[model samples]
Target: MNMTPAPKAVVVGAGPVGCLSAIALAKLGWDVVVYERRPDIRADSLQASSCEIPARIPRPRSINLTLSARGIAAVQSIDSTLVERLLYNAVPLQGRMVHHLKGNPTPQQYDRQGHCLYSIERGLVNLIILETAAAVKNISIKFSHKAVGVDFKNNVLRLCNSVTGQEFDENFDLCIGADGSNSIIRHFLMRATQMEYSQHYLSHEYVEIRLQAGKNSSGDTFLLDSDHLHVWPRGNFTVVAMPNKDKTFTCALFAPREMFDNLQYPDALIPFFQAHFPDLLSLLGEKRLLSAFQNNPRSQLITVKANLYHKGSVLVIGDGAHSFVPFFGQGLNCALEDVRILSALLCEEKGGCDPSAIHRVFKHYSESRHEDLIAIGDLAMDSHLKMRRSVATWSYTIRAYIDNLLYALSESLFVVKLSQTIFGPESTGWIPLYSMVSFRPDISYSAAKKKAEHQKRLVDSVGISLAILGLGYILHAFINLNKLL
Candidate 1:
């Protein structure tokens, strides 16, 4: 009996999204090969356990991602066991702890029902996903194998072995680019098709700052609130920190290019911190802050969008298709969702894992996924404005409070009463934009954007109307009291 061989797929970029794609394909009876330009991170016989706490994470590049519902669903969809492993290495952030310039820090919970986002290191996520992909019998992860060229017509990828300086051609039934914002596969794909692409680098740039574990009088690990994301929000500059399993906090400051340029020397570090972040100096200390300011690389934030996600049998997923600013904390989650969506599309193909159906599947996936990707990019950019300029403003705070209050009211009084009403229950009621985007995985990015706009208008109108009514009631009572007098 001759058995049909599994279809083959070559996935470029072994980042978190890339690894997930390979795993999904492998499970669907496809032989997969993942090519990464970087050397194998685990090559040094790095210990198996994520427990050995390093003084600092080895890699300088990390976005300090939070695993939200969309990302979590994607992970669980691939492997239920993976989420547990990732959670082990992650910190559950209940909400953001916003540190003001003067007063004490204020804690804002993400949701009334207490849905927490797990803050996990970017490197840890990739390593764990890579390990999961490695365990799959049909998936092979080749590090230091940079994708140099592509023959889209023939589904051929030209790779260069960085170690040996040798080049080779490999053919696949499908080629996937998860190679991040600056993807070689994306570059080649553009040459092959009339792909409309736009890349905008914002004035904002980020630099890493480390905070070693602090010990209290009891000698237990303590630093700020480990359960909350710490944010030092200044008008044009914001410094955010997320907890790590090693009892340390990974912090990054996002500031305008002018601000970063102004602090380009050792002497400028302390004074700038003193001017905007006076209190934080005590926690980070003088020496460490100076070192971080001097040594860390300042990375410019970029937003990327492409008109076409796929051409022929080649496709771009994750950052390759759409890269967003880190303000919304959706970069990782959005990338993970790409894998989940693509996997579903592949499964929907009538002939499961059939090589002949590749083009049709690619086209369908692109058409279905493009709008969501575009929506998220726009959402992230909008969020950048909120985080940078509006976060410290009273109007923003009031608006956020009003929005959350409305959501709580809807969930409790309105939604409950409406659902139980003889209205025959098909509605989910009002879901907050933040919840829809972060906590609600089923809501598409485009739908979430549209819903959010509608909700914002509703909230503003309701809030204004209620305020006017309250004032009217107060005035009417005063007028009646005066008449009695």
Candidate 2:
């Protein structure tokens, strides 16, 4: 009789990507273990909320993210039940409603047919993922297991438990690090192999504010457009809101580090909000603003680029490989995709027990994942300018209109494709490669962008035709009016 071997894989970090990574690997028949330095996020919820905790708490102005096709698909790929649960609690953002500094309202739908992104609480989402992981029978999740160092030469992970401060070492058949931006795993891998890395800190700082959803004259729950991501674009800074499952919204203010420093005390804070984020004051309240402003820590944004993602027996994914600015809201989405792709690749290479084989897989992951990571990172940074300034400009509105018109002309096939990729029952291959990459199961990020470009051209052709037709109609109407005059 022939019996299958129990393959073992270990993951660092119990964050969303890390949990999802363990889940995906477990589903592939690997005995998975996830090590997190902190306690169960739910158990540590209040304890985690220190004003000085830069590593744990959210930065005020940073966006939580709009989990679109790619992100949802990745999560669903691991467990459909988990996907349903996520959607049940999520706040759907059907479009971006850009509020100009001048107070003009314009909306842009993410999908051609008006499909939207979902707004979820980062902390809550992390909790759900972590809890789901804990329930997996084949997976072992050890909280408070901080990875202090890694030794690739002997395939060893050195960790210190937060509660005990006792040091220990664990060996895995294969280890993956989803340990995030300041990953110790990546640092260790660099020493064993030739790895190039660059870290850049942006000039921006962000602060979080809250908005209430009170009954208006009609007694509706939402104060702003509930199905849209609302933004107040102020040059060099911005205020954006994402709705919660509850009637409230989470608003964040992103500004320059210098500007944030100027807001030293609670008194200066109120007047500043009144001048810049005037609409938010009534909801945030003078007292809450004063307290939150005085209490909350300023969050600094940074981007890290790791050239080689792994060495020897270990591999790294998510923010450990590339950390980006939050403007595009793709940070989480992209991280989730990393797990999907890496899992599929490892499966393709067959269940691994060999260290050299694992090293080769990491090489492929780094090389293949690079283009998509770089492209998205660049797009995210570029979006900061758009979110803070251009969202209010005439050019921005016109460009959006053109983009939408093109999307509409495509018969919204890509939109349908996106929905299918994100919400459909089929596996990754059924969708367009872009849909697969962005929302499907296994396509790479670079391939997704390539497919998106093809679809964009088709949409653009239709838009140009509509523009020309509209112009022709105007010309004819002018000639007829002149003759009548």
Highest-lDDT candidate: 1
lDDT of each: 0.81, 0.74
| TM agreement with the true structure for every prediction | 0.91, 0.82
lDDT of 1 by residue, 1-485 (tens): 99987788999999899999998888888899999999887533323344333344445466588998778887777777777788877889898888888898988778777888988887777777777788788999899999889887777999999999999999998889999999988998899898899999888899999888987886758477899988888877898889888778889889888988888876887888988888778889999998887888888888899978888889998888888887778899899888877777777774245555888888887888888888988888888777766766788778778777777767733232211121113225576777878877767888888888888898889888999999999999999999999
TM-score (C-alpha) between model 1 and the true structure: 0.91
For each predicted model, how many residue pairs clash, with residues at least 3 apart or on different chains?
A: 0, 8
Residue-level error in angstroms, candidate 2, position 41: 2.1
lDDT of 2 at 80: 72
Q: Which 10 consecutive positions of candidate 1 have the poorest summed lDDT? A: 416-425
C-alpha RMSD by candidate, in order = 4.5, 6.3
lDDT of 2 by residue, 75-164 (tens): 766777777767766888877888764556778666544445788778766766777787789999899888888777777788898898
Model 1 segments beyond 4 Å from truth?
43-57, 216-220, 350-352, 412-427, 464-485
Candidate 2 stretches greater than 4 Å from native: 1-5, 43-63, 215-220, 353-356, 411-444, 447-485
